[model samples]
Each structure stands twice: as C-alpha cells, then as structure tokens.
Target: REKEEDGLETSPSKAECSVWEDLTLEKARLELNENPDTLHQDIQEVRDMVITRPDIGFLRTDDAFILRFLRARKFQHFEAFRLLAQYFEYRQQNLDMFKSFKATDPGIKQALKDGFPGGLANLDHYGRKILVLSPSIIDRYTLVDILRAILLSLEAMIEDPELQVNGFVLIIDWSNFTFKGWGLGSLAGSSGAEQDGPVGQMWLAGRNLPMSDVEALYANIPHKDVLQAVRNSIPDTITANLVAELCDFVLIHSYFRFGDNLYLQIGRTAMGTHMAPQYANIFMADLEQRFLSFCPLTPT
Candidate 1:
C-alpha cells in the first residue's frame, strides 16, 4: 500500500514508515475538525468554488494545496475559499515580492543569511515548528526582502504534513532593537514618561500574546470601538471629541510609500506610526477589561 501511494516499487524503510505513522498520530491529536470521511468532499467543494471564481485568477487546484487552506480554517469551505482568494490577491498586488520568491533569490538569500527569521530544528511540545526573528536586523535590509525570506521559510516548512496540522510559532527577540529601527524615532525622542506609557506597556505585554491574536484584533477593530478606547484613555483636560476626530483621521487616511508608489492602508492600522501602537494597546486593554467584567473567575 505504501509503495503504491508513494509510487515506489520497493517497500518504504522502517524510518519512513515510522515517520508516516507518527504523522497519522499527530493528525489525530491535533483534531483540526477535519473529518477524514468528508475531507475529499470538502476539498472538492473548495476547488469547485475556486474554479467558478475568475477574479482569483489561475491558482493551483491540487488536493494538497487546497487541503492546507482547509486545515488552516478547520475545513470550513467558504472561509477557506476566501483565504485562497486573498492569498492569490496578495501575491498579485505585491508582484515584486513574489517575482523571485525563492530561497536562492539574492535579496531573500541575504535576508536569510542575516537571520531575519531563524528557524529552529526542533519542534514544540505540540509538534509544531518554531521560527525566530530578531528585529535589530531590520535596519540592514529592506522590509520587502525580509518579508520574502520569512515567506520562503514558511512555504518550505508548510510542506510537512505534521506542520500543516499542528501549525508553527514565531519568536521575536527585541533585544538591542531601537525605536529608530522600528520607524518610531519621534516617539523615542518624547519624554521618558510618555515613551514608557501605554505603548511601552503594550509592547511588553505583546511579547506574550500570539501574533495571530494581535493581527486579528487590529484587522477587525471597528472605528467606533477604537474611538471609544481612545476616549477612555485620554486625560480629562483634553477634549474627547477632538482626540476622537484626530484618531478617526489617522485611521481613515493612513498611507505609506513602497518603492516609487504610495499606497493607502486599509483594514488594519497603518504600519510604523507612533499612534498605531498606542491605539492597538488601548483597544486591547478595552477588550481585556470587557472580558474580565464578563467572566470574573477567568485568570488574567
């Protein structure tokens, strides 16, 4: 059976058999809500959606490729379809990043050599792969190249079935990182108390939270919610309405320069802004307060 599946005339060795068995066991443990009996149907359903959507462009409709998105979204066909479209759309919009998206690409190779996203050989207790990043290296390379390196690493790692099922963790070391490196020199130059206020506290707290959590919070944050969070955090001497208006302006009209073109940021907060960190921290704190009030017994 293994020989047939693997397209080999000879039987797989003991090590290969053991690895397959381990992956099967790990899949069972992860329980991504994927029903083996219905998995083919699920994959077919998503593939069918992809076929009908001309806007997403020609995508790899192979079982393995579709299955990765399914597992990531717990086999929800619609959500997986949406993710598939976004995946292609992102690549389309950022042609430069994906142009030579390979480990050997000069820019990517340099970033990898600089340890932009260093990968660990060992897996976590959940059998998930771990990747580490050091922010201090950002100053040495363009952000696009760093992102390419990280994407290349993830693309290579995701080929493992166990990693697809269990996922991965990213560890970012902020040691020796400076505000200037993060494009926040203005904030760094502020008074000590201001520099160490909510933004500083959130930066410390963020180290403990999963990157996905932070991303999800910011991606789906309503403007009104952010305004309310800002309202609650500002000094009484400041006019709440005026601050709220300023916050709205920042959120609605945020833009950034990439290469020779300027791009407006949508969905999430603008990257590398002094106010961005504070807004995120304030909103996160508001969420925690709400959660605590709703569930008093839950540990902080």
Candidate 2:
C-alpha cells in the first residue's frame, strides 16, 4: 500500500519513508489498535466529544492536542475523553502552578537543576524515555515546585510522536535519605521528642530504640522482593487490574537525584510520599500471610 492510504506520507521523499518505517506506527496499530485509515475519524470523534461537553470549556480542540489523549488511552474514545477532561480539569484546579508555568521560573529552574525529575539521554529497551527522580530532593522544594519541574520535562518530551506512543519509565531512587527526611520522626533523637503531636509522642517512645535494632527487624526483606510480593498479592479482577496498572505507572515513572547525577531506584520504593508507606505495608502484610500459611505450628 502507498503512503497516502497508510497515512504515513507527509512529503514525497524516500528519506521520509525510511523514517516512517523506523517509527512505532506499526506497533501502535498492533498493540494500541490505532488505525491509520480511521485516524482523522478518530480525532474528529474525540473532538466532537470535547465540543459537546459544556463542562470542559475552552479546551484546545486542535488535531495535535486532541490526538495525544487518544494515543495515551489507545484510541478508546470515552477513555480518551475522560483523560482529556481530567487533563484540563487538573490545569484549571491548579491555577497557581500553571499561571506562570515556564522553564525560566525560579522554582522550576532550581528543581530542574537539582534533578528532581531528570531525563536520560537514551531510551529504554522498549524505546520509552527514562526519567530519574530523587525523593530526597522533595524536601528542598515545595510539592508544587517539584510537580512543575516534572510537568515541564513531560511537556518537552511529549512532542515526540515516538514518546507519545512508547511513553515513559520513571525511576525513583530512595537512597541517601533518612526517616526524618521522609516526615517520619527520628528513631533515636531528642529532636523528634521536642516536636508536638502524635508523631512526636510516638517518636519519644521509640527514641531510645537503636537504628540497628530497627534495621535488624526487617533487614532481610529486600526492596525488589517487596515489589514482587505486592504484584503477586493483588487479585485478578477488573478493579484490581486497574489498581495494579496505576501502581505500576507510579513505580515505573519514579526517579531521583544524588550529588550532581540522577539515579533510578531499581530496588525499593522511596519514602516521602503518603503512598510509599501504604505500599510497604501492603507487601509486608502479604509476606506475613505467606509465612503464616507455610508454618506448621500456630504461635501467637
């Protein structure tokens, strides 16, 4: 078939054909159900869906902008529409972040310099971009600042059609950080005891406990093992699958920084975010359950 029928031909050149061949359009068709024949039709359908929605007021209805959401959601019109709505809604709700959203903004520039979410030059095995993030950097900047830096990186990256299709891989390095850094009180310190709150009371109680003692309690539970445990424990249902996908999205896109270089946390989940503790607890529960089931004697 000619380039006109397949919708790959933009210009009449042999070089363009070679470039298209190297692109992931074939993969998109096979995996994401993207049809070059119905590409314009799909875009129009999503556009019409957007046009009818009075709630999603004044969104950019251009082909390029609308196509991104469609590509992200694998050409599913409703899912694409929902994602588009959420995209605009997020921007609308967080006006402060988007009001002066630019590369030159001081906070964003600083966050980028600190490598809060650093992009790797090379793509991964699957041709997806790899972003590195350091949770320790989170303490240095406001959540909004860090978010803006990430958004900036993403905005620059999504321009590539290959990236739009292949997406991204985030690696969050949890190293070079402490419990106190993660908002948890120090395990052995008067500093933690000085603070006022339930956290302070809890810290005061455990202040005498040595760090070695804490480490000894779960030193055997490796980070990779915990992730595997979580994966295995999730039930195989539609809701469960969605939850699993969301979790995977979070883990895969996470990245971190150390010194001047950025590193990917290949082993364990980072501390700092609320989700980290929950993720740890879920896997821990799974591990405990497995141990109890395997043990012959029941002991309290």
Candidate 3:
C-alpha cells in the first residue's frame, strides 16, 4: 500500500520474464521469429522470379502457396523453386489425380471412410498439426491416390498460420502390418520395369523428389546407436544385411540423442542439396515392420 502511494509503476515478476524467455526460445527454434513484412517480400521475390517459368507459372503464386515450398526449403529460393517445379511436374504426370482433385472427391472420400490416413484436428505442443496413417487399412485406395490425399491434406494444412511456421508431425501406426510383395530377393535389385507396382511407384515418386525439402528426421523411441549395437549381435547374415542397408537409408548424416529421441539431421551434398523429403515416409513404413521384428531383441 505504501509503495502504491509512492506512485511506483508495477513491473512484471521474475517468473513472468522467465516464461517470456522460454516462449521466445521455442519460437526461434521453430523459425517463427521471421518478420511478416520481410517474409512477404521474400515470397514476392520468388514469385516474380518464377512468374514466367513455363509450367511452374500456372501454379497459384500467392504468398500462402509459395510459402509452403519456401518453408520446406528453409526459405532457400532456388531450392524452393526446384521443389515447386518438381511438385508441378508430378501433378502434370498424374493428371487424373490433380486435374479435378478435391478433398471431397470419391477416391479420397472412400480412402478416408476406409481410414487409410486420418488427421487429428488438434495441434501438437509445438503448434504443428498432427497427421496419422494406418498402413493396415490401406486396402481400398491406389498408392497414387493415397499420395494425392496426403498432398492435398498438406496443402490444406499449409494455409493455417500455425502449421505454416511450425510444420506438422506425421505418425504412422503399423500395428498388425505385414511387408508383402518384394521379399529379400527382389529388394536387392536396383532395376526392373516388372517390379514397378504400387509400392515401387511410391518409392520412385519419393526418390524423384529434389533433395531440398527435408529438414531432419526425429525418432522418438529407443537410441539408434544402441539399436545398432544390438543389431550387430544378430546371427542371421541376410537379415543383418537387409537391416543394415535399411538403417543406412534411414539414419544418414549426424545423429544426436535428445532424451529418448534421436534426431537425425540430413547431410548436405557436395553440391549443397539436402536429402529427399519422402525418405521419412518410406523409412517409417519399412521401419515399423522391421521394428516389430526386433522389438524385444533390438531395433532393425
């Protein structure tokens, strides 16, 4: 009461200041510190650069649309351009899916009804959207159709301001799933027109993506290094070779332990390009089945 009578202005408490600092740190980690005006200018620059680039120009060049690719490439203009180009090229190749695609489209609707992939309306603690896929329930839709659903869902999510900066988390529940088709014999072969089926096509589409859109992969379970140790102790040579090869594809670049999770950063190539974004999806699908095999034993 005496302090108030002396007319001293109230200041925020130390706890409040600490909370503010934490929030700032979180925002910076998510790259949310970008100034709105500056970001808009950057988007405009890219739009102008690609405004007359043939097939790419036909795409919606609004800031919202362009920002997705830019965000995917960490605002790298040329990398974003390459991704944007690849995206359009994919769309062009699959005219039936892209020409008149809709969230309410029959194929997507049926897939949704069958629960091929489902999305949670809630955001993660980091404000990123949550998307879940159940591989076991993927019987109704073609692989291309499934990809289209995912891409379309992502397009819708990118429009949200929260998801724009924070991105999204994809969780695939592989419970009761089986690795069908290509057994060990066929997986080793690198070339064959006959091998190009749904899974193969999906892998090819993923491989075709420019190595700029991926950031890093986060595995929030057991330690990958420990998993590696146990995997080395396995007796079966062929199984060991398959697991090792798959691990090489999934756990590339540097790995750091954060609590129980292992964060695997994508290495930049000599020519300065990141790894393909599709590696995460492809890896997760295979990893789940492999993970089940070595659950009590060790991760494959």
The best-first sequence of candidates by TM-score reads 2, 1, 3
lDDT per residue (tens digit) for residues 105-153 in model 3: 8777777666556788655776667888887655445776787777777
Instruction: Report the alpha-carbon TM-score of model 1 versus the true structure.
Output: 0.57
What does candidate 2's lDDT look like per residue over 93-166, in tens digits? Answer: 77888977888899999999888788887678787899998886566666678888899889888988888888
Output the better candidate (1/2) by TM-score: 2
Candidate 2 wrong stretches, greater than 4 Å? 1-23, 187-300
Report lDDT (CA) for all predictions.
0.75, 0.73, 0.60
Residue 160 shift from truth in candidate 2, angstroms: 1.3
Per-model TM-score versus the true fold: 0.57, 0.58, 0.50
Tell me the spans in candidate 1 whose CA falls farther than 4 Å from its real position.
Answer: 1-30, 186-300
Q: Give the number of the best model, judged by TM-score.
A: 2
Lowest summed lDDT across 10 adjacent residues in model 2 is found at 210-219
- What is the Cα-based lDDT of residue 138 in candidate 2? 66
Cα lDDT of model 2 overall?
Answer: 0.73
